[model samples]
Target: MILFVSGCASTYSTRSVEPSGFLGDYSQMRAGAEEDVQLIYVNPQADFGRYRKIMMDPVSVYVTPDSYLRKVPKEQLSMLVNELDAAIKTQLTPHYEFVHEPQAGAMRLRIAITEAQGANVALDTVSTVVPVGLAISAARRAVFGTHSSIGKAGIEMEILDAETGQRLWAMVDERAGRKITGKFDKFSKWRTTHDASEYWADLVKERLESLQAEHAASTP
Candidate 1:
């Protein structure tokens, strides 16, 4: 069976930070004008910076029992995953060694595209067939509103200890349409899957650096 799911409403982005089984209140950290990057799970006692090598799995397409992920064209899905992998590797290479396979003490990074809304083919057709005024209206709505019928994407990631298979950290994030901003605020642009991957990779690097600093401070 195939089931299709559209992107969540833009207003819900802030409230969506509560991941399944997450204990932290991420909403407090969210800024009004930006998408929230929630750290859903973290092992407080784990020394994250101790790991020297990491094994990153190919990005997977996650789907529920009633979902239609399988219906998505294989070539399109593969392209998205490839872009995601490349973005992550590019950002993380400066921070840690990447291993081709899992090994003792190596950290494993698992990532999945858990939700997606593809470009609206029907709307595109309509825009071409209908009057120019209607097309302009549609474009304006896409840029300023939830983009409920347009392309959007979400991803989830987990960091685990390869040896013990223990989860060390996890996060889930989603994005849709361009960001709305005040005239005085910095202009915010729409983000694609590759952008999301880069954002998360940088976040991980920052977290590791903080952990290393904390460890150094405690050593003496």
Candidate 2:
């Protein structure tokens, strides 16, 4: 039986994904600079250099188009969210102070896991949680720069001013796992999701630093 994974979300597809409506507004978003799988927007008037702390909300599951992710077990979803949270925190902790409440110089970040592809046949049979690893297939790498048989994940994120609740940045993106040459098919169903979350977290840091540099240059 063919189980539907993430409701037709595909890493190889050139067509853009439709919004999951988790961000509420998509009017300002445009294609991301580094990849085809991203749609992003930044508030030009927002001052990135002023923020030194961040309040990150727990990652959530928000499947769209009604019921696409129902086939995935609730525990699996929980694991996925936890993995994302860990990955993002690991990436951002060095650069920013994580806080629990809104405070001066703090930005609020919210993220949601909107979609994830189902596991391959082997993974489907396993009853317990699988160990996560990012090993990709050679054939898939040559064709799509993605892992074969392994699943992909999609997410939506937004950053806001902690004080005023004004949105500063937003992004929606999806990704598949990377290829590991020589080491093959040591796969985990959630590895791509974990990798994608880390990538997004790094992007957040990169974007903020760029804005900070620009802000510093323009300061009198």
Would you list the C-alpha lDDT of every candidate in the order shown? 0.57, 0.70
* TM-score of every candidate relative to the true structure: 0.65, 0.77
Which runs in model 1 stand beyond 4 Å of their true positions?
Answer: 1-34, 65-71, 121-145, 179-191
- Residues 123-170, model 1: lDDT tens digits: 533543467735674565557544333345667777888778777766
Colliding pairs, model 2 = none
The Cα error of candidate 1 at residue 91, in Å, is 0.8
lDDT of 1 at 71: 60
Best by lDDT: 2
* RMSD of every prediction: 9.1, 8.4
Task: Look at candidate 1 and give me any clashing residue pairs.
Answer: none
Give the lDDT of residue 23 in candidate 1.
Answer: 19
Give residue 50's lDDT in candidate 2 (0 to 100).
Answer: 97
